[model samples]
Structures are given as structure tokens and as C-alpha cells.
Target: MNTLLKSQLWRGLLLAICLPGVAMAASIQALNYSSREVDYIAVENPGNTNSGGGGDSIRPYGQGGSICCFTVPEKWHADLKVVVVYQLSPDPTFHRETVSVPQYPDGKAGDIWLIVYEDGSVGAVVSLYGPSRPEWPGKIKGYPVPTKEYRDERRKQKLKREKASLLTVERGLLLRGNSLPDEKVKEIQEIIEFQKKVIQSLEGNP
Candidate 1:
């Protein structure tokens, strides 16, 4: 190993050791293999907090996928615990568990992964979300996203929802004979044409 690589590994290990409640971060295995700090990703379950304290709870933004991510922009100094409640199951109350990751100083751009599993245990998830994320594009990073093949389907679904909403408003306007401002009328016309094109594209019509 090179001097720089060894130095970073030691730093990561020392941080883990100093952290009071890190669950299972023995050696900084991922850090040792990383070319940069962003490449060093760690995951550990920190146990559940039924009251939902310690960190941010990020639910789905109603766009796509079945995952949640919580991040603290300041720095990675301590373990951030998240409570994952599984609401769908035969049992009345589902499992509630927590997971966490060692702190990443803001410059390192580190991220903590949280997964709500079927068994009701929310723990440290891995980085299998892939390379490109067009859904959120830039805001969301180092997180799980649907595959490119599925992105088109998601986009289509979003467009359909928007189209339905527009039609509902336009119907109301028609019944009331309301005179919408000129700009509003133009915007709605553009949206109608856009939806028609999207539907045709999805059907492989051209």
C-alpha cells in the first residue's frame, strides 16, 4: 500500500474506534481500497429509536423507488441512527430498527444508507444504486435509484399524473366559462401537446 492510502485508512480506523456507538465497523476495509474520500462508503445498523430521534427521516419523495436516505451536511463525526418502521405485514405492528455510519467531514462527501426491509429491520444499506441517476439528477447522490431501463417508465407515469391533473382543472374552467389569463391558457396548451407526444413515444409510435 502507498503512504497516502495507509494514512487515510488509519484515519478512518481511528475515527471508528473513537466513535462511541458504531455497531460493526472493525477495519476500514472500504477506505483502504478507495482512491478518494467519496469512494469510502460504510454501513452499520445502529438499532431502532421508536421515538424517531438522532437523524433525519427521509421518506420517498413520491417520484420513484422504495428507499429513503438521510444525510447530515456538516460532517461525519458520530453514528447517526434512523428508525425504520415496516408498515405492511400480517402482524399489527411491524419491526422497528436502526442503523448508522461513522461521521464524514463535509469535505469528504460521505453518505449514510438506510434500508427498510421486509422483516422490519432498518440497517446500513450498500451502494448498489448504480452510476447514473436521472430521476433526481444532481440533488441526490450516493443513493439507490431505479435502472435506466426503468427511468422511461417512471417518466411516463409522472407525465400521466400531470396530464390527469391538468385535464381536471381544464374541465372545471370549461364548465364555469372562466377566462384564464393569456399566459395560463398558453401554458395549458403546451402541456397538452407535451403529454400527447410523451404518450406516442412510450407506445413506440415514433
Candidate 2:
């Protein structure tokens, strides 16, 4: 074979051997959030002061039940769809809300925002308060609701009891100022764009 043809053949063989390894590395770098089942008490009229009957008129909302929860590690991103079913006479109402929470800006690590939708249209954005927050909106008064103090105390006690269980897979890797590789970050942004497209498709928005 001519020298030029031999060089070309060698280049092709090298690329064939390296391409699969590159693809496998890319797959390993991708982050995924584990779906967890959590029970949260859905309160109707979150603005209601009284914890009336669990229905729609006064304190209309069901008690705690299992719902899928997604926990995204820092420097990663996740799109979660939370569905809540309201049981009422005539017909039951099913509400599906999608939230895209990106774990950037390390200070907002614990911040959670709820995107409410009505008939596939954006309704409101509700910020979920974590254990350090003073108060949560729509909190029923005169009721023995779990307070932030209670949660913090329980979390500390649990951590003390089960130190091994407190270690997350990405614990030390998610420290402040920690960042994913530039290529991985760009890939994550593309995933976010894809999730946005999915949301728009679900809402029937062109």
C-alpha cells in the first residue's frame, strides 16, 4: 500500500478502538437521581388557617401518602413530575406538576421550588422551606404540625444514631465551588433543554 493509504488505515483503526471507550466514559459521567417514595400531607387551601375536614370546601386535602421523590446531587440536574390526586364527589381531580431543579449555586443546595400547573398551564411557584426556615406558607394554625425545630432535632438524632447511613454516594464530591467537567456540564444543560421540551409537549404548547 502507498504511504498515504497506510496512514489513513492506521487512523481509522485507532478511532475504531477509542470510540467505544469514549462512549462508555460519557455514560459513566452522566448523573442520575434515584426515585424515592416519600409521604407528604397535601393540604388544600394551603392558605387556610384552620385544619378542617380533609376535603375541598374547608381543609380539603388528603393525609400523608406515598409519592415518588427525586433527589438530585449537587452539580447535577433533575426533572421530576409530582402527581397529586384529589378525591372528590363526581370525579377525582389529578394534578401533575413538573419541577426542574438544577443543583448549582451551592448556597441553594437545600432550596426546593414547586411549580404548580392548572390544566397544563403554569399557575404558581411555591418555594418549599427546609429545616432552617422560620415558617412555611399555608401552615395550619392551632394544629400539631411538624415544625422545622422538630425536623432538625430528629435529623440530628438520626445522624448520630446512624452515621454510616448519613453518608451519601456523592457526599464529599458535592462541596461548595465543586463543579463538573465542562463537557459534562454542557451535556447536563442539553438534558435540561430536552426536559423543557418534554414539559412543553405535555402541556400541548408549540
Q: Pick the candidate with the highest TM-score.
A: 1
- Model 2 TM-score is 0.20
**Candidate 1 whole-model C-alpha lDDT, 0 to 1:** 0.40
- Once fitted onto the true fold, the runs of candidate 1 whose alpha carbons sit more than 4 angstroms away are 1-53, 60-121, 125-143, 147-159, 169-187, 198-206
Worst 10 residues of 2 by lDDT: 23-32
Score every model by TM-score. Answer: 0.34, 0.20
lDDT of 1 by residue, 163-187 (tens): 7776875675576445777777777
Local error of candidate 2 at 192, Å? 64
Stretches of candidate 2 exceeding 4 Å from the true structure: 1-69, 76-91, 102-108, 111-206
What RMSD does each model have against the real structure?
13.9, 27.4
